[model samples]
Target: MKSWRTMSICLLTLFLTILMGCSFSQESGEATGSSIILEFSEIETITDAGVQLAYDDVHEVKKIDNSFMVYKKTASDSHLYLGSVRDKQLTEYGFVGEETYIQDFTKNEESLFGRPMTLITGICGANCVENYLFEQVDGQPQLILKLSGHVLVADLNEDGEKEVVMMQGSPQIEIHVYKRIGDQIMKVNLNEEIGLTNSVTYNSQTNVFEMIINNETKQYRYDTDSDSLISL
Candidate 1:
């Protein structure tokens, strides 16, 4: 009986030791996964001065975070750079061709998944504007969304998360709305009764997206429960 008890105690100790080892490995992996190391430059030298008459002329340095910075010039057909402060590497994110320039770049106050985002606009053609939404994922700059025209991010349906609204085509008759579903972005279906119009507006009173066509109004409210839009 004494021998059996001693063996049982030894087995219990071995099991506990293995379990603790597994737990420690998992914790270490989680910590390492949370921190992402990026390969960036450590110098101010930039390639493709980008339509600038003068080489190495950069202005308007904006700091997005401790690691990322954006710099651009105000001259016509200028370039924009997204650089890493820690690494000192610069990437030209703005337009470069002739008859084009960096229009505007804005950093939204809201964040998703503990990562901040920036909206950038550049003119590519006579009537074409390229809109890009950049987010930091795993400590690196990521281009999450690119659109033909400009985009607006707002809680159009008064939901907790904001939705993306994009106006496509020349007359802006084709308005598209995208919402976040699970880990993907999906387009929201509009009510069939809603007519096609370029005069789309958000109605705060009803918490719905509205459009006015030929003096007639059509409203569509997003049903969070159904993940669809209901005509109001």
Candidate 2:
């Protein structure tokens, strides 16, 4: 009878331990989920040109020096606005177009036309994306360049300037490179498309750009003279 009692007690203790562990795991998961939702969905307030702007469902908020860029989405459309705070005053600078399907807004690390730039991506179709590049100029945001497909920016030539690499994924994957010369942003003539690519990224260590396609990696360097990407 004593042995039976001991066995029952051991079984009950094991069951209780598992129950407590499960409860703790569930609570932890709930807390993490709530944190993420709050981080994105919480109501936020900002002063734009002395006008109070209260927004929720915030997609992204970026700070550039004394300026702030906020991207917010609604059930049907999305809005992006830039504002600056100086001398205890808030001033609105620019507003993006009424885009119905804005996907992402990001700031490039490099400057364009000797000014900071930001990119806004919008979805047009099942596999098509439009990228709008905006440069902060004279206390305002100016739309400088626009492209279709996936875009990545880097100083591909190490020339103290950033280049835009675009990969078009529909119909077939095509790679295009663009560089700013003087006041014009010109598309580099590769003569031939880089063929198929899953993604393109800059490798700072190698000072070149890397393209991945079907688990295969290829490296490329921009040729200033030829105006093309030389596969290495």
Candidate 3:
């Protein structure tokens, strides 16, 4: 019994140490005020040739910075591209399958992975709704997470960084939250007892996220230090 208890204690201590290490790394990154632009290099200006020109074909274009733009195409399907109007070149980034449409785009004031972060939503393949969190990772645009169902992107914890909240499964009651810490993106734990309703709303004034069903309403606030959600 003594031997088993000692082993269990050791394991618990090791686990706590690893978890604290991760938290320290994330806090360190935030403290330094990292820039997202450091993760990406300026696209090489290419001569007019075989490069697909998405600049003209896109339905809407949003500037990432002075050098790059995100273009959205809406038709029977929706597609998104990371392209340059000056270089006349573009690269398809997210939502490519069957019958997709871009639903919304939001920009985070703070950088994620040393590059500007974008939250995008779309419907793909037989009216399936999909949400994507994107940022430049190692000189390339990368999708941090792509999930199906209703989605929202906001700074849930009032931290400088925004979190991705997505609702999956039928009746849209299942809720999942994703937070970006340092170089990693993780899914945070949420209270399952407080079910979500048809409408999930955020009040910028209070910086609170709320879910309402029938007459019952639940509110949550993000705990930045712990990287978790707390009920308000």
Pick by lDDT: which candidate is best?
Answer: 2
Give per-residue CA lDDT, model 1, range 1-232, as digits (tens). 9999999999999999999999997755331322212121222222432222222455544566665455665654244555443333355444422233433444454443223666655555566666656677777566566566556666764655676766566654455666665666556323222334455555445556666544656556666665545555
Clashing pairs in 3: 36-114, 36-115, 77-100, 78-100, 78-101, 157-222
Estimate, for each residue in 12-129, the C-alpha lDDT of model 3 and write its tens digit.
9999999999999775443222211112112223232224555657754456555445555764324555443455556554443232333343334435434476655555544456
Residue 223 C-alpha lDDT in model 3: 67
229, model 1: CA deviation in Å?
2.1
Local accuracy of candidate 2 as per-residue lDDT tens digits, 96-202: 43345333444444575355677665555567666656676776555566566777666776767776767776544555667666666666323133333244555
What Cα-based lDDT does every candidate model obtain? 0.53, 0.54, 0.52
What TM-score fits each model? 0.50, 0.44, 0.44
Off by over 4 Å in 3: 1-114, 125-127, 189-206, 209-217
- N/CA/C clash count, model 2: 1
For candidate 2, the 10 contiguous residues with the lowest summed lDDT are 34-43
Pitting candidate 1 against candidate 2, the one with the higher TM-score is 1
Counted clashes in each candidate structure: 1, 1, 6
The TM-score between candidate 3 and the true structure equals 0.44
* Candidate number with greatest TM-score: 1
RMSD of each: 18.2, 21.4, 12.7
